[model samples]
Target: MNLKDEKILSAWEEKQSITGVHKITGYNWQQIAKVLSTYGIVANDTHEIILNLYDRGKNAKEISKITGYAETTVHAYLPRVRPAYNENISENAKRIKKYRQNK
Candidate 1:
């Protein structure tokens, strides 16, 4: 972790709100959320998109097509998928896993 992050954690331990931390660090809530998740922080925005797609039962490739992000990128964040969400499968999705996976 960088010095800024260390300081942010210290501030957080002192009960600083995320908005406050963002103000001090100039980092978005998502970036800060990722850091917190690394330490087992459950409330972060981690898996937000993954869960959104997963609930809809969209595969990594389908999510990639819809999101324009690499399938691997979507797959990589699977671990963070929300524990509770819809689990319906996506239909008529174009498979683009190869292009993204090879990268």
Candidate 2:
């Protein structure tokens, strides 16, 4: 690998997000991932990457774009990691009722 590629790989190995690596190296996430794969370096799982991005304050859509997962999938898995907020039992019931009705 060239010196520049080596630096980018080092940054990726340091656990920098694909976005961070892109910013520093000018290589998009897909290209970086492909290169990593060629070196037999496996990337993180979708759920783990999504949760990390979410914890860093990225919304579901942004996380989806970054991680290449469907937004619906991200939404489905997020509630498992982050607690759902309900102002009251009534509000929770109302939401459930609405959801059931929609279904």
For lDDT, the strongest prediction is 2
Where's the lowest-lDDT run of ten residues in candidate 2? 79-88
For 38-65, candidate 1 gives per-residue lDDT tens digits of 4444333435665577568898789888
Q: Write the per-residue lDDT of candidate 2 for residues 1-103, one digit (tens) a residue.
A: 5565586688887765666777878876656655554454545576467667877999989988887888876664453332224423577799898999999
The runs of at least 3 residues in candidate 2 whose Cα sits more than 4 Å from the true structure, single-residue gaps closed, are 46-103
Model 2 clash pairs are none
Q: Each prediction's TM-score against the native?
A: 0.38, 0.38
TM-score of 2: 0.38
